[model samples]
Target chain A: MHIAVEEEKCVGAGQCVLAAMEIFDQRDEDGVVVLLDAEPPEEQHAAARDAAAVCPAAAIAVRE
Target chain B: MSAPSRVVVVGASAAGLSVAETLRRRGFDGQVTLIGEEDHPPYDRPPLSKQILSGEWPEERVWLRDEATLAGLNLDLRLGVAALSVDPADRVVVLADGSRVTYDELVIATGVRARRLPGTDGLAGVHTLRTLSDARALRETLAAWPRLVVVGAGFLGTEAAAVARAMGAEVTLVSDLEAPLSDVLGAELGELLVRVHAEHGVKIISGVVVREVLASGGRAAGVRLADGRVVEADAVLVSIGSLPNVDWLAGSGIDTGDGVHCDEYCQAGPGVWAAGDVASWIHPAAGGRMRVEHRTNAGEQGMAVARNILSAGHPAPFAPVPYVWSDQYDRKIQIYGSPRGCDRFAVTDGSLAERRLVALYGRDDLVRATVGINMVRSVRAARALVATPTPWDSIEQGVTA
Candidate 1:
């Protein structure tokens, strides 16, 4: 599975990091989301999806 | 008891959509049905008051998931229909179109409706922001750059005022509180927000009650303040607050007090659950019954409800450090927890003079919430303090102020 993020759409809520720190991180300068892993392992798919679903801004999209 | 084979979710907004998505993701192959009152598919609402209202993003951009994506979920999608009532004992829901659907488990995610000012019904040029249609109508009206009067100092009203002012409209913000958001963020922060709006050319009038909506020729002309002064306007937005969309559950035998009253597990009754703004549940960590209207809470609570429904009789409690944010002009205000009724508030990082800081709210000698104004990283770290509610003295001791 591959995940993509839109920094311009990111609201800096830091929800992605909270849901899956291994796959997502937020920049310290501003809380815009940073995709740590565009392609995560099999076991991390669920967490990656959760991060996408919980994003209030709909900034994260996961393609499986 | 075994997991239910059929799950029906009402309300197709953020929370309801989240439940459906999570269920499918967690391998729930049960027959899932999602109902919505609006014709459009599920969409994000936070942008309604900011991006959509400002015309920065088109209407289609606010959709939570594209049609192809939502269709991939294999849901029995019902749009442009309302649930009239439910019979918990019979496990049946009656729709407005004279149809019935029986479910083994029911999730009610019907959110809140914007409260309208009395006697303002059908008045042209008067509006309320809630649904996509509402935002679209308001945006079209704002294009004319009318003299807009926003009644209410809450987040929605303030955000709309900022957007209108930025659009070159003559904007007047009227609030009952001493300052904007003072009721939730306290007077100091509220005054700061007021100053920001004032600097941006928004005429703010506070500590006043709106007596009525003034009209002429069957259209909204302005608003008459309780103090007998009238503020003329080409458009007016009544945004005092919202009421839970729980009227349909009138005789459902489930508690519909402030909202659908539920336990810490989001269960309203046997085989019944509630989420989103319409859910008033007992929060274990806060040790109280609270209803959050924030966008993030809706998705989080919906996911929790979905998992709990499939937990096989051992449903875990839904306790989250609620998060809320509002965008007004250049300000990106964020809150990690509930700051209402907090007795002690201190700025731990940055300074209010610069309008960028991380402030902490303490209640009962424990850190209850954190507020951030353009200082996102510090506020993100402060969540730990609110999650466990560290003692006030310990947090203060670490403060370099």
Candidate 2:
């Protein structure tokens, strides 16, 4: 699975990090999103997908 | 438990919509009906304070989903209709439009309404935000109103004040307590919020109560403070708090005090569940019951309830370390776990002088919650510890590094 994040669109609500911290991280400066892994394994797919779904800013996108 | 062949969900906000969507995602293909009083479809409420009100995001940007996508969900979408009564015994809901919808299962997600300034509701230019129209109306008036008077210093009021000041409007934030959010966040962090607002050019008035809204020519001109002082403003936003929307359930035989009381499973009655601000469930982690008004809690709890509704009685309890965040003056206050009534609180990282720190709420020398001010990564890391309730001395040892 492939995960991509639009950091510019992130408002830093931090929901993604809460849902799936393994795949997402927030900048210390402004809390913009930074993907820890562009591609995740099968075990992390549910969490990565959940992170993308709960984001209020719609910053995360996932492709399987 | 027998599988429900039909379901009726009341309230079309975040929690309600989540219940319906989660049910669909869980493969519940039975008849589903989603009812909402507002004509608009479900929209995100968090941005109403910052992005939408500050004119950074358009009104439609807050919509949860497009009409075509919502229609594709294959659920009966009832908008602009109010549910007058919920008859749990008969498994029927009476609508204001004289319609009766029977269901094998019911989910109450009718979230709270903004508590208005009692006498000021009729006054023009005075508003309380709990809906899309409220934000739209306030945003329109804020563009022209040079001075914004925000009553109450809680999250809603402070956020509104911050956004107004960002728009170059003069803002006066009035609070009855000496420090903002003191009872909830403890005095130190509350005072930090006060300093942050004051440093951002918002005039802070503490320990003063609002007596009544003063009107001029049938319009809100200003407010009359309890101490006989007047704060002039072209528009006033009252954000005292909210009351749960459970008056319709008065004779419904469901246990409700302040909010609908349910077990850890969100079960209010047989085949009936409640979620969001409207449902106060017994928290398994916290050992008490509390209703969470934040959007994240609403969404999580709503989804959990949906799964349990399909669980056929062997359901897991919805116990979580509740997390919520607030953005103001370009800084974010993020909290993990419920910190209300915590016995002890200590700073674990950074310093207050730097406008960045991580504070831990401890109970019995064990960390129960964490709050971060501009220290996102630190708080995010500490969240795992909160799930297990780490000890206080171990946290101090880690902080020494």
Candidate 3:
């Protein structure tokens, strides 16, 4: 699965990192979301989707 | 998108409504459902303690967005229906009646409730103001009770005391701290708050904790202090603090502490998000986790949450210049930015004794925050100073670019 993030609308409220740290991370300085792997292995698809789902700003998009 | 994804918003207060409105405004045509525990629509809360309590503005005036706004957005609002539980895995929100509504996105803005005095069980005239119902009940009692003993010298307590005093009722403000607002605003400003109350004829009792409510005939008589002092009064106003409403997330697998932990974007977990008083967000500027309970924070954070929800990728971080205001007596106090770790303050525009001035707080030779009392223009200048780090000397000289 591949995830797309809209950086314009993201607030660094790190809900995505909590859900799937391997998939999403936040920039240390401004705390913006930093998607580690846009597309991950099949085993991590659920976590990626969960990361997208819990984003308060709805900034993440997961695609199969 | 096949069809605008279904978004379920829990709580119809400032945070919830702001998210829903921002969703529709951002072209999210999907089914949007807003569920509120209260029967009334989302209303402005800050005015509840001031104008509404003083009878200057009616209850209806506080309604934030009217039915027209809801209809214009093409949003479905479910008022008076409390959300019982949320299943993040299934993306379903369970209502009080056991009905389940599935959602692609969920926003939790349940807010907080007033913490009451424990073991004060059978107090007849004790009151706490949080919701419209509480305010209405207190308003009715104020007409009958001529004296009010306000527990806690915080913002709400002081405001209520001022309103009651304006209504010709005797008010005595009791606080556990050495001065009112000591914990938040520090001892210096806290002492000023106490003096303000005292000058207004509101008796100020500091460093005393309420042991219990002394009652008779199933009604409140007075409060017994930890210092063994019993102050007589007809009614008591408890404004100690607020506890975030996170009980529903007990087994919800979401990492919950004092509040639902969220990143800078205000996300909680997959398909679940939180804002307002219920969100313990990591402040970007401060680099620390803090929960902001102010109305401005709730509205701004809610909008940020909505924008992030509609985006396709990692969105821009939501970082607002945090601001909060309180109205007491004739003074309008405005605070900008986080006031933590400030070692020095400079009075820029006016004198402190005049009670209409601007004060800048600085740390490490950089401006940290600003507090303005009845000085609106200076507050705007101070806000600019907070946004960009400026020297204390420059701030004292009223330098702004």
Candidate 4:
């Protein structure tokens, strides 16, 4: 499973980081979404998909 | 292990409904059921103080989306049904009618209620406005009561006073502070609000605490001040603040504080999420946890919760630059971002004397937030700045120009 994030639409609300901390991180300054690992392990697929679903800006993309 | 995902949403307000809509929008073909204590469908609450109170807009207009919208999405909406307990361990929500609904995911969007005056019972003309019923009752009372005494000078209290004054009711607005909005907007801006109300003939009483409600014939007649001053009135409107609805989460095994504790993704526990006024999530910027109770926060947080429920992995963190607006006496006050820790402010456009200006709050040489009074364009510009890391020097230069 892979999680792709579009940086343009991200508002840095940090909903994705709460779901999958290993796969996502927020910028220290402005709090924008930073994709730590796009292709997370298969076991973390569910959490990554959730991160994609909850992105307020619709910035996250999930591929399985 | 291939059972269909069952999502049960507790509360059909902005957060819950937004989650449902977001789920369907994201192509989630799962069973989505909404349980609400209110019999009516979810409605927009911000208008309650402005248009609804002023009689400019009707009840139906405040509704966010209608029954057709809900039906189109095929959402199972259980209106007027309250959740008695939430057994997160078993992933089930128990209702007041002894019915239990099991869910693979849950979203808690239960909002807050208006806080009432302490020990002011048995007074006929006392009112607190939060829901549709409260507005309707206050509207009826305002029609009969010639003089209206408002007990607080916060956003709601100020808006109500403006509406009541516009409706030809003599309004006496009392606040614990020397000026209205002192705690939130500071003394300078607070004084501006006081001036605005005074210019409209709304009697402003400041720095006075209400000792007791003076009643005659089991009806409110006036209020007694601690300084031995008596202000007579026909009706009293109490708009102190709100208390988040998190009482039912007791013993539910969910981490609860002043509100339901959630992380950045608005998730409280496994298969459980919360948003709106009742959810306090961690703020990365402030390095603390705070619950924002604004319309914009509710809508955005609700949508975020919806996506989190559909997918198991963490979504992006909920880090919206907080924004809120209030309309009173033909003036709109808009705030972008949080200004709690701001140390300095600079006026960019308009002057305080003109009652039309934009002020930017800065901390550690960065523009943290901006506030505009009757200045919409600047607020939009400020919102853009909040999304980026802009230095205070550049912000000042841009605003001055």
Candidate 5:
């Protein structure tokens, strides 16, 4: 699975980091989302998807 | 006793949609029915006060999902229909069109409706911003640059005031507090917002109660303050608060006092659950029952409900460090935890005069919450301060260091 993020759309709620800290982080300067991993192993797919699903701004997109 | 063969969810907004999506993600595949009162598909509400109001993005951008993605869920989608009542004992929900749907499990996420002043119904040029249609009407009225009076200086009212003023409307903000959002963000930060609004040419009338909305020619003329001072306007937006949509569950035997009363797990009754703004559940962390109206809480609670529904006999409590945010002009105000009733508030980082800082709220020697204005990273990091209610002394020492 591959993950993509839109910095402009990110509200910096940090919900993505809460769902999957290993796959996502936020910049310190601004809270725009930081994609730590664009591709993840099978075990991390569910967490990645959950991060996308719970994003309030719909800033994260996961392509499986 | 067994896994639910069919799950029925009421209200198709963020919380309801989250439950349905989570169920499918968990491979439930059961007959999932999602019902909504609005004809539009599930969309985000946070943008309605800003982007949608300012015409920065079209209505389509607010949709939570596109056509093809929603179709993939294969839901029993019922749009533009309202749920009249629920018969919990019979496990059936009666619809407005006289149709009934039976379910093994039920989730209610009806959310809330915008509160209006008494006797303002059907009045021309009087509006409330809650649904997409409400935003559309308010936007159309704002385009004409009418003299707009916004009652109640809460987040919704404050944001709408900023938008209308930016749209070149003669905007006047009237509220009972000393400053806008002082009741939630405290007077210091609230005063900072007052300066922000004033610098943008927005007139603010605070510390006065609106006695009545004046009408001339059968339209909203303006509002009369309790002090007998009158402010005339061509349009008025009332943003006082909201009432949870629990009236439909009148005879359903579910508690609807303030909202759908639920346990720590968001369960209302046997095989029944509630989420989003319509849910007033016991929060283990908050040490009491609470109902959050923020966008993030809606989706988070929905996921928790779906997980508990699938787990059946073994349900986990929904404990979260509640978060909420607001955007007005150049300021992005974000809050973590509950800041209401905090005995003490201190600027731990930055300065209030600069309007960019991190503040902490303490109650009974424990950090209760944190607020940030244009200081996103600091506020996000401060979540740990109140995630489990840390001691104020520890936070103070850390700040001093």
Candidate 6:
């Protein structure tokens, strides 16, 4: 699965980082989300999808 | 509680909706009935003071689930239906509409009511922001840039100040405490937050309490401080805090005081569970009963309660490393783990001079909580330390002041 993040939409809620740290991170300056793994393995898809779901800003986008 | 043929959830907010949705996600396809006092569907509340108040995101953007998705769940959503009480013996929920629905399982997520200052109600221009209508009404007046006096100076007060300031309105925050959030977050961080708001042009009057609302022309003209000082303002936003909405459970025999008392699994009794801002459950970390009013806690606890009910208490206790986040303008405050009972604090990154860093709080040699000021990675990493805390010296091994 592939991951996409809209940093501009991030409100720095930090739910994505907590849900899927392996694939998502946040900038220290503004707390905008940073995608660590653009293309996560199949095993990591669940966490990546969870990151998208829990994002308060709905900033993360996961595509199969 | 075992997997049942029917489950009824009251309060359609975050926790109640989470339980109902999680039940379906966990393959509980039985008849599910979700009742809500509010006519609108479930919506997110965190943005009410942030994006919604600031008018950055529209009202629909804050909706937790779309109408299509909600309909797809196929759950009996009784919107605008107020639950009068619950009968534990009969396992039935009585409604204000004079209808009773029998359930094999019940989940209470009544949530909380915003605490209003005495004598402030019935006064024009005085408001407490707890619902969408409150946010929308307050936002409507933001365009005029009226002088806004925010009482309490906690998360909601500070957030209201930021939102008002963002709209180019004059904002004054009257807080009884020396620093905002000092009661929850430590003094040092609270002071830093106070500075953050002060720097953003929010006139924070600390160590001062509002005695009464002075009125003019039958409208709130200003607030009278304890020191006989009157702070002139057109509108006053009263945001002291919130109280658990548990009055409906009165005489129901389920156990409730400040909130519905429950076990670590959020079980109040057999076939009954409670979660979110209304559940005062035993906290494994704090070693005492606590009610967390944060959105994330509501969601997590709701999921945990759903799992435990389905698993028949086989699931692990809902021992969450408490996490809460606040957004005031450009700066964001994120905290994880229980900061209570902490005595020592150390900044692991950045410094107070810059007012941007990750500070770790500890007590009895074990790290208790971490507060980050625009330091996301450090805060994220600090979650690991919550599970396995570091001693004072170990935590400070290479930390710079």
Chain B TM-score, one value per candidate, order as shown: 0.99, 0.97, 0.95, 0.95, 0.98, 0.97
* Residues B185-291, model 4: lDDT tens digits: 76667788889999999999999888888888989899998899999999999888899888888998999988899988888988888988899998777567989
Steric clash pairs (candidate 5): none
lDDT of 4 at B297: 79
Which docking category, incorrect, acceptable, medium or high, applies to candidate 4?
incorrect
TM-score of each: 0.98, 0.95, 0.83, 0.83, 0.97, 0.94
Order of candidates by lDDT, top first?
Answer: 1, 5, 2, 6, 4, 3
Candidate 6: regions farther than 4 A off: A1-9, A36-39, A49-53, A57-64
Highest-lDDT candidate: 1
Give the per-residue lDDT of model 3 (tens digit) for B128-233: 9899888887888787747789998888999999899888889888999876786656556666777888988999888889998878788888899999999988
User: Would you list the C-alpha lDDT of every candidate in the order shown?
Assistant: 0.92, 0.86, 0.79, 0.80, 0.91, 0.85
> How many times do residue backbones clash in model 4?
26
TM-score (C-alpha, index-matched) for candidate 5? 0.97
Tens digit per residue, CA lDDT, model 6, B269-319: 988889899999998777889889888888888888888878965866788
Q: Lowest lDDT 10-mer window, candidate 3 chain B?
A: B392-401
Q: After superposition, how far is residue B361 of candidate 6 from its true place, in Å?
A: 0.7
Candidate 3 lDDT (Cα, 0 to 1): 0.79
lDDT of 2 by residue, B133-203 (tens): 89989998888857888999888999999999888889999999987788667777889889889999999
Q: How big is the positional error of residue B258 in model 5, measured in Å on the Cα after superposition?
A: 0.7
Scored by DockQ, the top model is 1
Error of 2 at B210 (Å): 0.9
Off by over 4 Å in 2: A1-9, B398-401
Worst 10 residues of 4 chain B by lDDT: B375-384
Cα error, residue B379 of model 5, in Å, equals 1.2
Show where candidate 4 strays beyond 4 Å. Answer: A1-64, B1-4, B398-401
Tell how far residue B81 is off in model 1, in angstroms. Answer: 0.5
